[model samples]
Every structure is written in C-alpha cells, then in structure tokens.
Target chain A: MTAMQEGAHVPSVEESDEPKMRDVFSDVPTDTGLATDPAGVVIAELGDADPRILTLSADVGVTLAEFRSRHPERYIEMGIAETNSISVAAGLAASGFVPYVFSMSAFGVLKTAEQLRTGAAYNRLPVRLVGRLTGLAMGFFGTSHHAVEDVAVARAITGLSVVAPADAQSVISLMRATVDREGPVYIRIAEDAQPVYAEPPTYRPGELLRVREGADVTLVGHGMGVGLALRAAARLAEEGVQAEVLDAAWLKPFDAEGVVASARSTGAILTIEDHDVVGGLASMVAEAVGRAGVAAALGSIALPDERLEVGVPAQLYERYGLTVPNVAAQAKALLGR
Target chain B: MRVDTAPPATTPAPSDGDDGGPTLDRGRSITPVELARRADWIRLQTIELIDRAGLGHYSSTFSSAEVFATLYYRTLRLRPSDPAWPDRDRFLLGKGHAATGLWPVLADLGFFPTEWLDTFGTAGTALNDHPDMLRAPGIDFSSGSLGQNLSVGTGIALAGRLQERDYRTFVLTGDGELQEGQVWEAVMAASHYRLGNLVAVVDANGFSGSGPTSDAMGIEPLAARFESFGWAVREIDGHDPEALLSAFDTLPDPSAEQPVCVIARTRKGKGVRMMEEAPQAWHLGHLGPDLRRQVVEEISGRMP
Candidate 1:
C-alpha cells in the first residue's frame, strides 16, 4: 500500500514500544503504515461502486487526484471557489446526484457557510462536504487556514450532520456509513494519518465509540484528539489511574445517553478536542451533562479562545497543552488526584 | 397576519378581455403576444401578493416577470405533474426576493394549487419572500442569499453533463446581485467547464435596495465581463417578450462547448408608472389599496 506522500504526518498513539505518553509524542513516527490518501481512496471506491457518486474539488487536488484519475468523468474541479462549489454540490444533489465537495476546512465551512446553510442544509440535499486540514494542522499557515471553529458553525446549521474521523480506518468506516444519510453532511479531517482504530468499525451518527473502559474518569475526544486521548489514557494507566476513552466521531446527533452513562460510571469527565474551548466537544458535553443533571465533575482541555501563533504542529500542540501528558494531567485534575 | 387560504385574486390563465379568449395556459409554448400578457399578469399578481403580505421587493420582482414568464411559458421543458422529474430543465432565481413573482407563475403551471399563492408570508405558509424548495414544489432549489443560485444552476448543468442527460439549467440573477463575488466565481466555473447546458440571465434593472446598482457597486460592462470569462454573451430588453423569446430561441444547443448568458437590460419597475419612474423608492414597500388599484389598472392597460 502506498503511504501518504503529502500533508502533515500524524503519528500513531497505539505504539507498543513507548512506555511513557510524553516519549510517544516526542518520538513522532515518520510513518503510520496507513494507505496514502485514505479519504480519496474511499471516494474512488465509492465512485466505482455507485454511478450516482460525483466528486468536486476547490483547487485542493492532491488528496483527490486519485479519484480524478479513476473517475475522470465524475470529477469536477471548481478552481479555488469554495463558496460556489458548495452551492454547486447542492444543485447536483437536487438533481439526483450525490456530490462530495472537498476543500480546506476553514474556507469550506466558514467562508462558504451561507451557501452550506441555505443551499444544502436548508434544502435538505445529500451534499457531502469534506473539509481537510482541520484544526491547527496547517501549523505554519497562520489562523486563516486553521479550522478550530468549524464544528460550531456546522452544528448551528440545522439538518447538517457534523462528523470528525480520527484515522484512516475510521475515515473509510464513517464515509461509507454516511454516504446515503439524509440531508447534508460535513466531514472534518486533519492532515495526518494514524491507525486510531485497530480494525474498521461500524459507525452510527450520534453515538460515541468506546475505545477504552475505566472506572475513575472518562476522556472523551474527537478527530485527532481521539488518538491523543488514547495516549493519555495509557499514561494514566501507568500511574495506576484508570481513564475511560471515548471517540466522539459524530458531533451532531451526539450520544447524550452514552455521555451520561460514561459520566455515571466514571464520576469525572474531561472533554478533549483540537477545537476552541467553547462551542465544540466540550460545549456539546456540557449541554448534555447539564441537561441530564449528571453530578459528574466536568472539565475540558482545548485550545484557548485567542489567536494561535505560527509554528510546527507539535510545538503548537505542546504550547496549547494538547500533548498526552497535559491531557492526562487535566484528566487527573478532574479526578482531584 | 391573516392565513388567507383563498385562491389569489388573479386568473390562472389570464383572458384576452375583448374576446374572452384564454391568452396563456400551462402549455410549454406560447406566442409572443401571449407571453406579454402573462408577464403583465405576473406583475399584477406580484403587486397583489405583496400588497396582501404587507411588504416585499416589488421593483426586483417587476424586473424579472418577463424573464420568468418567458422561461416558464416558452423555454424550460418541465413535467408539471412530476416536479421532480430527472430530465426536466431546472430554473433557480438568484434574485430570490423577487420570489413573489415566481409564486404566481408556479401556481399557474399547476406545480401547486393556485390557492397556495394566497398564503404568501402568512403564518405556516410555504411561500416566503425567499424561495424554499423544501416547502414548495416546482422550485428547483431554495435561494435567498444573493449570488448562490448561479452556482446551484451550474451544479445542475454539470450533473446533467456527467449523467449524459440533455436537460438545461437556467438561473435568473439581478444586476444588483452581480456585486457579490461568488457570482463571478460561478461565471468562471461555468465557462471553464464549458457548460453549454447552463444559461444565466441577468436582470439588468440598474437599481438595488439602496439606489442604482452602479452607485452601490459598479458591475457595468456586464456583457464584456461575461465574455472575458468565456461565456457566449447577448444583451436584450428584459421587459420585451419578443426580445426575451428571441434570446431563448437563439440559445445554442446543450452540446455546445460554451455556456450562454443573456444580459437582460430591464427597468426595475417595468409596468407601473409610479414604480417605473422611482425604482429606488419602490425597491421594497407596502402598496396600500389605492396604489394597488392604480398598479393593477396600469398593468391591465398595457396587456396585449
């Protein structure tokens, strides 16, 4: 299998050779043994399987080049027009074609929000919006490229399904699951590839995937934060602290019951995500926990609601307390340990 | 505030008053004379609908009546019985505040019961100032935000090309809405993709909400701009049914390599003397019963 040649490198958190979570993060692996362009491969496979599947790109050609070659007739290049591309996808969906529009997360979700809102979601069309380079993955590209607030924007649009897939396997699983889902779907993906899931797992929107189980505290994460949570859980285990891990792959239709159940079991919950401190996983958890009136102590480890500096992703992650050690420390703090 | 379910006080098919002959119906083809009569009726009903609804964009709707009438009556190939027919030509209105004008046309087409037109802007009504495809049938796509419907129409045209279907997609945009940057993006994409199946008609009414579109943001030399982006361009009198008919009739085949754009120069308020004389003032307003009566008389007087 070919490895991803371009984009940011996402190291695997499931590495068995590392003893400490800090060491695993510092010793970032150059390869994760995952397929090259996992999202593109899934799209190409879908095009092969279904004739109605059509793909559109807004000058983000690297990830979808394979799909373009495989389904030349099915691909459309909109050339740096993210706003127009979204409405085009809606029009295509309105005419019995399933359109998957690809663009950078910031532009695709924020820049074209009105088109996504009135054109796709309000029309209740099945236009798949694949927003790549999520979060601060475009580390040195400054704030214009980072998409930390896409979840908030997408979630606010009624009838839009918001999803974040952590790794290659989850990308395949989630893409296939939501292919025919009613209404428009916004899929958030980062520029890294790691094996977060040991195998392809079944996906249902609004449900949390339990990655690990513990009794002391729950570490709920989505997107790349899922892998970070797993590493933090492993680090807590070394200290004889049991940390339950949940992968919040779906943000919209969030599993309130599962969240309440986890809080009931663990008594403490720390929501982690590569998004802002508000209006994301933490906010969603807070709403659910608040509505359920669950007495579990709740905390969140997320990016500050301020301007982020330009640097490599790892340095930025460390600066924002997004490393495994910080996550574990936050979880322990929630547990008052 | 009234949920008026009464059929709109407008004829489904306006009759030629002298002979009492049906001038225009749901047929896919109509004479230029019939087209002119239907366009006048669209203006008359739009004034009535907005007059009842208390507020609406009268000038924009007035400017687009002839284009809407021309497309629905003579240009588009649609199965009114099956509004969702895959092969039907798609029409999206970018200047969607003018939707009151389209509501009456869709009702006349039998896409929905004519009674639905009376419920415009009322509580729980499907019709709004902006078009919503989910609430109403015969609307190809919902559009309220300016500069979006062209992209939607481009998308439909692209899909038709990929599916090997020969259906065309028409998008009517206001000249004021051309100030939006996304419209240029759609213009570029339509040409770059060589979407012959796509047709965009710009209602060059010269006036927007604030004032003349030139003062708001100059999108003048509109034909040259479209041609620079590789579209086959033509400019005509938007209010003239014969000009509108010729523009639609002369459109290139869907298999052609270039997309077509008809830059329709039109008056903001084409029929009513008060509105035509002062378009900016009438961009959006409530026509009280007295002015509403005068507007109906003006429209009826101009009918062929």
Candidate 2:
C-alpha cells in the first residue's frame, strides 16, 4: 500500500526509469469499443435530454464536470458524503427530479447500503446510483478502495436494480434505457473494461447478452469478467475447444432463465467475475442452476474470500486466477477436455 | 383526581410583532390558543393509538406533540384535501419512532381516512411504527432510520429550488439522532448548497431510548454546531406555541443563501405527569385500563 504513495513524486511513466505500481498494467488495453469517456460524457447527454435529470457527485465532481458546466443548476457537488448523497437523491426523486448519484464503488454501495435500502429502495424512488472504478480498478489504493463486495451487497437490496456494464457503450445504453425506470438502479462500471460491444446493443435489465456462441462450455461474466470471458473463449478456440460467453449484466433481476438454458445446453458453466466468490454472479448462477435441477458441472473464477493482495488490477487478477489462461483452463477442466 | 406535579407550559405571549419576515401558513384562521389545544389533543390521540398498537415510543411521541401541532396547525402550508399538491410545503420526520404524534394531525387534516389510525401497527395498516410516504398520502418521505431525513429534506429543498418553486421543506429531527454521523453530512451539505428553503427543527427533548442524550452521547451546544456549519440558528421553547410561531415567522427567507435550524428546547413526555417525571422509564411502556383512563383524563383536563 505504501509503495504507491512512496513513488508519488514520479510524475510520468516516461520520466521514471523503473516501472511503478501503476505502470504494471501499462500494456492493458484502454479502448471501450466506444469512443467516449462514459463517465464524463454520457451523463451530461442524459441531463441534456431530460430537464428533470439531476447529477450529483460525491467528491468525484471531475467525472460530472461536463454536466455541471452544461446544466449548472442540475449538478450538485455533495463533497465526500456518500450516505448523504443517496438520501438526498431519494428526496430529489421523491420531489419529481431524477437524480443520479455518482461515486466510487467502494463508498457508493458498501458505505451507504442502509441509506440506499431504507431511503431510496424502500421509497421506490428513481435514484440512479453510479459506482465508478468498481472492483480492483482502483489498484494500489488498496482494499479500502476496492469494491469486490459491492455486487453482493447491492443485489441483496430489495428494490434496487444491480447492473454491471461491461464497457462504455453498455453504460450509455443502460443509462438511456433505464432513465425512466420506476425504482432505484445501481450501475456498476469498471474504469479499465475492454471493448466487448461493437455498438450500443439493445439492453434489458434482467436479460443476458450472449456475446459469443459455442458448445464445449458456458463462460458467464459481468463487468470486467465479460472481457476475461471473451479472452478465455478466444484462447479456448485456439485449442479447438469452443466456449460460449454470456454477459450477466443485471444481477438483481438476474437472468435465471438464461442461466438455466445455458446450463442445459452446454452442461458446463464457468462463472468468471471481478468480485468475491461468495455472493456475486457465481452465487446467483448457482442458485438458478440448483433450483432448475440442471445436471451441469459448475465452476467459477473469482476473487477468493480472503484479504486481497494490494497491487495493480492486472497483478491481482493474475494472482487470483482471473486471467484468460486461468479461465480457459477452468472451462476446459469443467468440460473434462 | 387532579394529581399535578410539574407546572403546565407557560401561557403563550400576545402575537403582535411584525419584522416583515416571511410568514408561514399566512391567512390561516387557526389561533395560537387553538393550536396549543391541538397539541394536547394530539397527545391524547397518540396515547390511544399507541395503546392500540401494543408497543410504541410513548415519550418520544409526547415530546414532539407540540412541535407536530405547531407545524401542521399553524406553520406548514398544506392542502388537506390534496395531499399531493406539488406546491405544498414538505415535512419529514427524522425521529420516525415519534410518528404517532404526527399521524392524528395528518388524519384530521384529511390526508387519509381517520380509520387507518385504528389499525396502526397491525398486519394490514398503512400506519406503522414509522411514517411511510408510499402507504400514507400526507407523508413527504418514509423515515424510520434516524439521521437520514435531514439529507432527504435537503434534497426536497434542492428540488424545489431547481424547479423554481417556493415550497419549503421542514425536517423534524431528534437531538439524539444528531449523534449519527450522517446528520452532520446533511448539515454540511444543506448549508453548502445554500438551501434556504430547508429548515431542520431539532426536538431537543434531552432523552433517547437508553437515557439522557448527554449521558448517551453529548450533543450540547447544538446551536453553536449548526452556526459553525453556516446555518442560520434559532433557539426557542418547543412547547410554547407563541415561541414556535415566532421562530417560524423569523425563519430565513426561502430565497436566502443559508439554511435554518431551530433548536426547540423541550422535555420528553410533556403534559403527562408520570412520564415527564421519569422520561427514561416512559420512553416506552404499557399502561393498563385504569392507568390509561387516569392519564387520558389528566391530559384532557389541560385542554381548555
């Protein structure tokens, strides 16, 4: 943890002779398949489309700078108070304005679960909670900045729609599609997600997007997991083993039917996610499979339920078996091939 | 059986001052005497409702009866027949356990059928231990968890400001609830946003569920705290209708830059002799038929 702060004075990667903790993932792809800074640009467009749309930032005003400049009155800077932001958003929703609360996933979901549950979900308000830089994307900022438990916590909240968008296009499409959604929506976005969609595809909250079709095994993922699943499918294709990929973006009103269908068709399901293994996409898939009585080999590539190691996201992903090779091998092992 | 120990609230002063501040609920015909009597009526009705419910925060409701009455009967701008009037002022109960105090007022105002109060806390009743805005028409926001309503109220005020409406938002919070860290978050945000349409009335009854708020957690110099946070501060007798009316009269204009906080000093279980004497014990308790009859008679005697 101190390693990041120790080299804070090293201004640029080019200037520093030695690779820093942040430079560990220098080769990681930055393209979101869509040419846009989703956080800075999409929300502003949404505000422009609707007069009642208000965007609130909790110490992350930079993400909403465009919206603030365009619709100055609709943008609110709520400092570092995530709990207050949720309740305030609920109030704004109650008063007929759709408020989008933007914050780090670490604070947005985990720190304000009660407020989100009692204030927004209980009241059934249209408060859109946007959690940016979810999972280990915060990297060297350490575990406090990571949000591995966000999905588990958010999915348990009754009326909240827990959504994990794989890339910038998904975030934009989902935001536009669900702006008029009746109740609260939790939008989880990873800062470093690879491009998975060629364009803004049709998005429904509880429906799964079949990114790639195969037969040997089913590779299910959400958020950063989708990219890993895609990469794993490509690697498996090289080995003459075809793996199907499903993007489980909506976790709350989970795609149970799709999970059951995939389980029955493929007979092998491997869930890969950038979250703790206990109560995330894997747990939801497991429940769906068990309830359907499907005879399938189930496996998961996820963060272990323990204190996570502090490093760049790529390093942690590799250490935790969340890479393409590990996922591909896991799928192959599940298929007995 | 006139068993009186504590003195009754002081007689309300004559209402004659006019500093030209914005008057809340102007043109209303209800007098201060009628409003003060309404507070007692709320207390009696709350006791009956709580007794029906089998479990409730008696003293918590008692302490805020006058605050509720003062707001509903004299302060708030409301359309009883039209609870969803977009222009009507909004009130949120941060200390939601004391919701019984405000339930009768909303019912009498015709926000919902009075019969709903009869089945309170039952299986199908919309009236529960806390106020639910979805179930009950008059509630501005649902609040059982303390310390969150202030932020909600701030949001409502922000909405009003954004929509270019003059509706004010009042949040009734418990002093004990101020101990929760979220309250300060709202306190800071409300002032930072310059929500002049927001007013947080602290029911400073000095008793929480455990014991004295000071012993439980010292939140003294509350006025100074709000002042430091850039809020326009006012301290007044919560039980006195005149003082309450004056406080609301002198509140910062809805267009002003600073939010307002009225620290209304009060006693838990006010108007009930036994409850007031030992507020901690009466924070929550059951009364038998005889004791209930006696308490009812004693409270009703103070009406006229």
Candidate 3:
C-alpha cells in the first residue's frame, strides 16, 4: 500500500504494532446530563427553566416539534427559508431573548452566512446556530446536506465561535455554554444518535478534554470522531500500546496550549475529524502546533478532498478510514511498531 | 402646544437663485436655501470624486446625490463619528452603485477623512466600487448585489421595533433592482411583521443597465405596487431637495398602520445637462476631457 505522507513522517500500514488496553470509560462519571446516557437528568434540567428556550428549525422541523411540545411559544417553524430564520433569530436576540436557530448544516451556515456575518458577528448579537446532520451525518442525503465546510466558514468570521460536540452530554453542555457566551456561535450536531463519550466534568468551549492520557501516541478528535478515537484508544491499550485520547470540542479559538502540552508530553499526535482534512480540525491543529513551535509528528484521519460517494454511514466511514480499527492501525504505524 | 397643520404647497418652479444661479431651495419652508446650497456643494464634491477616480456608477450616483444630501444634512438623526450609535435612524443604500454619492456624503458628515475620497478605485483603498461595511467607516451593510439591501434593512427595522427603539430604517432601491425576487420577499416580510419603523425608497430613475426601465423590465405604477404590498406610499420629484425633505419629514407613524414607501421619480443623471437624459451606457462611462471641463463650468455657473 502507498504510505500517506503527513509532515516529514510516513507511517506504513504493514509495519504497525498493537497498543495496550486502558479502560478510561470506568473513570468517566455516569451522572453526566445526557439524552442517551441519562435521559431523566437532561429532561429534569430542561424542565426547571425560568423562561423556556426557543428552538427554531428550517424545512425538516424535526427538533422544532420536540422543542415546541415543551415550549410552544418558544418554538418557531420558519418553513423552508433558512436566511429569514437567521435574521429572525437576530431580531429575537436584540429583544434579549436566547434563540437556537436549527437547520441542516450546509444550508444553515452557507446560505445564511451574510446574516451571520452582519446581524450576528458585526452586530455582536448572541444567537446560537445549531446545524444538525453535520459532517457526513446525513450519509444518504448526498453532498448538498453534508456540512463538512461549516467549521472553516464559521471560524473565518470574526467574533463568531464554532463548536462541535462529540455526543449528547457534550451537546447539552455546549448548548448551555453557548447561551452563557455573549456572542454568536455555530454548533454542529450529528444526525445519528452516537454513543456518549464525554464524562461528568462536561465539555467547555475552548477546553480540550483528555479522555485517556498516554505517553507513546496521541489521538486527537472532535465531534463524532471523539467517540471513534476513545474506542480506538481502548483497543490500542488492550494490545500494550499506550495511546492518549483528546476530545477537541472547541474548533475555533482552538486550545493551542492544550494541544501543545499534549503533543510535547507524547512525541506523536494523530488528529481525526469527520470533516474534510483540508480546512477542518486537522489543518487547525497542525497550524496551531506549527505556530506554537511544537515538534511532534502529526497525522490526520479525515475525509479526503474528493467528493464522497453515496453509501450507508458505517460503510462510507470505514471506506474513508474513519473507523476505530482504522484509527488504531494508523496510530500504530505512526509509532513504527 | 397644539400645532396648526398647513395645506401642502403647489409644485414650484425649479429655483433660479436671487444671485443668478440654479435656485437651491425654492418655495421650501422647512429646509432653508443655505442648507440646500450645502447639499449642492456636497453633490458637486461627489461628482468631482467620481470624475477623479476615473471610475464609478456616476450616472446613478448623481441621480441619488440630492436624496443622500437631504438625508445626511437635513433629516436623518445620525452621529457620523459614532456610526454604531444606538437609537440612530438607519439608512441603507440598496443601489450600492451610488457609493460614489455615499462616500462624499459620509466624508462631508466627517465619518472618515475626506482625503480618502481621492484614493477611490485605487488598489487597497477602502472606497471600492461597492460599499463594504468592513472597508468603509460608515457603511451599515456591504451591498453590491442588488436585492439584498432591503432584506437587511428589514432586519435592522425589525431590530429597532423589537428593542422598542424609536429609530427608523430607510432603504433606497433602484427601480430596476425591484426585478429581484428577494425585494418582494422583504416587502412581504416587512408588511407581515407590521414593521412601521421601515421606510423603503424607490429611486424611480426610469433606467437600468440596458436602457429605460420600461424598455428593460417595466417597473411603472411603482407607487401603487408598494401600496398594494401594505405600505403607505408617497410619490415625489426626487431631484427636488425640498420635496424630498417634505416626503421624509411626514413619515408614516409605525403605530398608525403600515410601513412607508417614498417613490421618488428622478432622471438617471439629474444635475449634468449632457448626462441628465443620457443612455444607460453613460452610467459608468467617464466624461471626456472637453465634457468634463464643460460640466465643471456648468456647475460653477450654477453656484451662488
């Protein structure tokens, strides 16, 4: 197989070694307020609000229904128009109301980019943009719905922070943080209900959570890839290879200090994300490391530049080398095991 | 303090100054002739900037010069030094081609250094052919693509209403620009939301890129169209500064009923004699050396 070159280091798949087992999940607190892990906690927390949060959705209106049943006056169904919804949310924000504008990732960020740039960023309005079905999460919907480019676009706009939460727990925490943060924010949520990975000490914006700390290799991931990285780190640990797992929940205002500390602690770092390798977390981490003068060898496991072919989420993920097995194999190769 | 309301004035003749120049403000009671002269000076400065830059939508810029002058100098409650001052009336130039007019107005209002006008069309200059809010100091929204300004204006107007601020938003759209579907969407949305704080001005200059608007896309009976869209419509001669001022002064109260639309009928190139009735080609085409000298002579003769 042709070896992929990632900044001076080439890790051949054939010359890879297995990693050791370390069950970090046991250390993770089960009491985290997550929809999947502890639905009761999330439901209870949401129930005790002064003024219920308003949730707006684009055409699909799936989340709109759920938010409306709980907070009817708060839910706004803006039909198929995403641009108008963003503007309306800006207006709502001006009225001292917190509004969560939900839409498909592609249309949500790209279509209403000008509104976000002017109404939210320039005006310094506090509005949370929830882009559902992000990063190839809409596997069957093809390229139109896939929001792989949202992170880069959101990051480019000044005063707008971008976050991608790994699982349900991280989503709830990030959503809470977004409301508290006094500016515009873009949050990418996957369509599929992925397994919860973030522990009790909930994910915070601009903070990198280390799931499992190791000395040999580091597995850096954000959003959906965090779950995959944790699973791969566990598999690597079982085979005697020590691999560190880091969840990069915050994409913009990236935690360079955390990344550099982790990279210098370990000699090698592997960044993984569900987005395209070009402008997403991989490029961001590399740029951060380069600017910080960190000399760790970095490799990225992300979607290739080519247009993705249509297939089932699992099939396409495996084909694109984003699975736990693939990440572990790449990590082992990086260590020259 | 009961105020006595007077009847509207008749259509007065285009002014000839008592000192033997084009009358600046003839028969206008509210805005004085001195203010009109300042507006004219601003307009002249605008023409000079466009001519010096060797590029701009000069024809369109000239068409809206009087309106811009009237708004900045006489009407709009704005602080040029602090463009982002809360509770200030918002003015969105929908036809961004009129950046030539806007740049001069903003300079006159001391939004930025007046010397910046000389750098127009040069590389790395903030004064581009289009108005970019990031680049220019006083620009509220970056607008070059036609129909987007009204929507943005609607957002600003909605912001004012939602915040319970008395500030009003005024958006100027070229007659030709009404061809875009988004403008109608904004109109519908503004009316639907009962945004009385919004005033949409249609510069019915009867010209677009190709030729006359009727020959191009036909946006006539424009006042009625706005009225049908649930707006309180007013029609006036756009070139008349006093008439423009009157239309703006009597803005419909948002609490009363609907939004307002001021349909100002104007010539494509109003001030310069040669280009006043010029074809659409003259919109961006520069005046020759001889024509430029002639325009300068004509403008100088019209001054007091």
Candidate 4:
C-alpha cells in the first residue's frame, strides 16, 4: 500500500499502464450469445442506446481499462478510495451521466453506505453500483472481505433498488434495467463462474422468475443460491415431491405478490440465501408470507449469525447449510414429507 | 434586479426599511441591519418551532446565528426556487447541531414555506434534529456524524473542478468533532488535490459534550496543524459578523496551492445571557418561559 504524504502533491496514478491480471474463469468465452451476457450482449445493447454507460472502479483498474479500451471516454479509474468513488459517481449522475461504480461489495456498498444514502437515494441521483465478489465469493479473503450484510443494509435504505443476479445472463439483464431506471440501484455480482439459467430477455427487477413450477412446496432463492434452489427442486422431483423454484432477483421492493401466490399454491415454503438469516432474503420472504396471511410452514436455509472462520467458499457454503441438499432437506422437513 | 455586492456596515444600528441597510466596502459582503433584523425574526421563528416540538440544538445554533445570517442572506449564489440547480454553490453543515439555525435561514431564503418551521421535529416533519438533504430544501448533503462532511465536501469540490464549474463549496465543522480519523483523511485529500474552491470553517466553541475541548481532547494549536496539512489557515472571532465576513471574503484564488480553513473561536451559548457561558449540557437544555422572555428582551436590545 502506498502512503500518501501530508502537504505533498500526490500525482494521479495511471491505471492503464499497470500489468493485467488473468480473469478467474478462462473456459468462459469472451463472447456469450445471451443478451445479458458479459461480452457482446449487454455491451452491444448499451452500444445501441446512444452509448451512455460510464464504468468506474476502485483498485480493479484492469476491468475498467478493458471497458475503456472498448468504450473510450466512458470509463474512469477512481483508484483505491471507495467513498470518493461513490460520491463522484453521484456527482456524475447530477451532470446527466450514467455512472456504474464497481468495487468490492464490502467497501463499495457498506463502507460508503452514507454517501449512497444521501447523495444518490436521498437526492434521487441516477447511479448504478456494481459490487463484485458479493457474499462468500471472496472465500479465501476471510471475514473482512465477505459482504454478508449488504442485502440488509441496502434494504434499510429507501429509494435504493437492490438486485442480486444469479448468472451472467441475469447480470446483463439486471444491469440493462438498472441503467435505464431513474433511481439508485445496487447490483451484487459473484466472483466465481455462474451457471447460465436463461437466454435472452428473461430477467427484470421486482419480477420473480419461476424457474420450476410445482404445488407441493415453494423454494425461493437469490444470487448464487438460485442455482442451489433449482438443484434442490430437481432432487425433490425425483423423490415424487414436486417443489416450485422462484428466483428472487430483486431483494428490495421484493416480489411480495409472487411470494404470496407461491406460498398459497404450495402448502410449505423454504428460503435459501448465502447471507445471514436475521435480515436477509429469509426474513424478507417470511415478512411477505406473514403479511399475506398465508398458513404455510416456512423454513430458511442461511448462515447462522456468527463470524465465519476462514475457508474455501464451497466448504463454507456447505458448512452453513447453503448447499442444494441442505435446502432440499429443510424443505422436506417443512413439508413433513 | 442586480443584487447588492456591498458588505453590511459595522455601525451597530438598526434599520426600518426592508432593502435599505448597511453596506460594507470589503470582504464577501455581510447582511445589512435590515437583513439582520429579518434574520433575527427567522431565528425567533426557529426557536419557537424547536421549543414547541421539544427538540433542537439551541446553543450551537445560536452561536452561528450571525454566520448563518450572512451566508444565506448575503453570500452564496443559490436558487431557492430550484434547490437542485447544477451550477449552484454547495453549502455543507458539518456540525449539524446548527440545523435550527439553518431552518430559518432556508425559510427566509424561500427554499420552503416559512410556516413549515412550525413542523420542525414533529412526527413526519421534514425538519429534524440533524439536516437530511432528502427531507429539507436547500441542504446539499445530510450530515450529523462528525468528520464525514469534509470528505463529502472534498468530493463535491473535486467534481466542480472536473466539470469546470465556478461554484464554490463550503463546509462548517465543530472544533470537538475534528477528532475522527476520517477528518484527517479528508484534510489530506483536499489539500493534495489543491481544492482552493473549498473553504472549511471550524466553529471553535471550546466545549464538547463533556466539557471544553481542551479538557476533552486538547486540539490546541489548531491553525498550525491545518497549515502543516497544506491548508491556508485563518483565525477569527466567530461571534463578530465583520471578522466572519472578512474571512469569507478574500478567499484564495482557485489557482493557489491549497484549500482554506477558518478557525472561528466562539461561545457555545452565545445569545441567552444566563446560558451564554454555561456548560455544554446547556447546549440542548430547554429555555423556560421566564428565560425565553429574557432571551427575547436581550436579542431585541442587541439588534442595533
């Protein structure tokens, strides 16, 4: 870490000149055919819309550098300070520019939460915050890096739309919707490779995508847990216990109607999330069920309210009962089947 | 109509006409006696609103009455009709305890209805103990947590330079609130960025929550510290309208080397005679009916 000297002129470091680090996933082609995929789909869509997207990130200059190379004058490298980055993005929005500020979820959303609340949500400024390595994605980075409280914090704030994309295609669609949306939005992205669930024009905020429809039990999940929920549904189907799967992409202004309808259709409900059970997806869905006056028994598969010891991401998920089998078992127990 | 550029005179005389008031020859002009009287009426309104709602930081608010009077009444190029105007100057109240002072100033400046002051601190009222930019009109940013405003102000200043706007940004912080680590982080960034367009004023009222700042944290030799951090430091009597105006006036040219800091030493409970030199607890203590009447009389006599 470079120390900034007091009373000295600190020149802005040129991020483009730095050597690039290899992207985590190599098998995933740069060009994915889905409309919301990373390479061509979202970029092409944005390119056709008068090209109003501006990408900015802290410390992750390589990603911004790539975007800048593709879309010159539309990218800014804000360096290591996340608070300044968010505030500048708010200012940029005030000037009629659409800025997507990228940083680690912990620093990007939680560290500079006050700025996002005052500058963007309160002022109704249009800035999309894209936080990478959300939840347990930074598995090896220990507790300090994991952003388990982002969902809760973002939900507490008003006028901020919070979305967690399950895969690359969903990410593209959510990003597209967030850019066109007139208010502040936070998009949490996983660091690892996500399984593609949909093709084109499938995801939208406040709309729950029913990945699998059934009546025995409703399994609702978001972010990386969406894939786990689908797997659990498949396993339950083999056992002749039909389970409905709902992808709750948007966490705030949640799909209350969809959740209520599913709970009424199915006699039981289970919520799976890679966050704390206290204030995350589980609590949100439970609130909706209670408000809808649904009599269905509900269970939540989530991390216990304790600091997770350092370990691999997959092991942590399994240890915290966030895996497919864990969710399926919880749903079975709720259904008493 | 062309706005008057002259500062208010130091004759300590009251005026009768609405627009005909004292004019000063130097500094970012002060509010004339007529305007000061109008401001006093607004201040009285604010006091009534807080007292009725049973919430306010009356002592800190009273200390900066003259500063608020000058800024909202004379200085600042603001459009009350359009609070979100992109080119307007930014005013960030770091020590948000002075929110009571701001409500009346904003009302007088026509940012919101003057009658809204009565709803201050009431349930569902836009006016609260601290300034919320979302709820209140003309508040650039919501600030209550100490030491965060300077960083936010620095961000705004950087944005102004990047966008090439001539608008200036001013942040007011408390002397005791400067203990947070984030304050130093912002101070370093602002001076390193050479934010001459940013001017920070420290309301050095000696006392914190417990007692005098020296007794609490000892932030003595404050001006030299700012100077060492690459800021042009100025010390002034915060209670004197002339001194405050002088400090605000003669701001360093944007082409200069660093940001500016004005350490304005003031009394915590400035106006009310009984509480003028009282302890920090009086910062928010209620002024009883008898004390209120006495305060009114003191303010009326001191108006000229």
Q: What share of the reference contacts survives in each candidate?
A: 0.98, 0.96, 0.12, 0.22
* Model 1 lDDT per residue over A1-337, tens place: 0011123234445655422222211222314455566677789999999888989988887778778899888888888889999988998898888999998887889998898888898888999999887887776667886788999888999999998997778888899999899999999985553457776677667899998989999999888888888999999999999989999999987899999999989889888788887699988988888999989898887777888756556656767777787888888877778
- What TM-score goes with each of the models? 0.90, 0.92, 0.75, 0.81
Model 3 lDDT per residue over B149-180, tens place: 78777766766664578877788999999997
Q: Per-residue alpha-carbon lDDT of model 4 for A112-205, expressed as tens digits?
A: 7887887778778777887777777665577997788888898888998999887777777777777778678888875443464655447656
Worst 10 residues of 4 chain A by lDDT: A1-10
Q: Fraction of true contacts reproduced, model 2?
A: 0.96
* lDDT, candidate 2, A1-337, per-residue tens: 0101111232333553533454312232348543345856788998898998999989877778779999998898888899999999999999998999999888899989999999999989999999987888776788798889999999999999988988777777888888998889999977667778877768666999999999889999998889889998999999998889998887878999999999999999999888888899989999999999999989988777888877766667667776777888788888887
lDDT of 3 at A176: 65
Which candidate, 3 or 4, would have the higher lDDT against the true structure? 4
Backbone clashes, candidate 3: 13
- Pick out the ten consecutive residues of candidate 1 chain A with the lowest summed lDDT: A1-10
Model 2 steric clash pairs? none
Q: What ranges in model 4 sit over 4 Å off?
A: A1-56, A68-99, A113-123, A180-183, A198-200, A235-241, A321-337, B1-49, B118-126, B254-257
> lDDT of candidate 1 vs native?
0.82
Residue A165 lDDT in candidate 4: 80
Off by over 4 Å in 2: A1-36, B1-27
By DockQ, the best candidate is 1
Off by over 4 Å in 1: A1-32, B1-29
Candidate 4 local Cα displacement, residue A218, angstroms: 2.6
Native-to-model Cα distance after best TM-score fit, residue B49 in candidate 3, in Å = 3.8
Question: Tens digits of per-residue lDDT for model 1 on B1-304?
Answer: 2222233233344433223222332234577777777878788788778877889888888888889888887777766666777777888888889999989888776788988876887998988899888888888888889988898899889888888898888899989889899889899989888999999999999998888889878887899899999999999999887888888998888889899999999999888889999998889998887777777767777665
Error of 4 at A168 (Å): 1.0
| All candidates: DockQ | 0.82, 0.80, 0.15, 0.20
TM-score of chain B of each: 0.90, 0.90, 0.86, 0.87
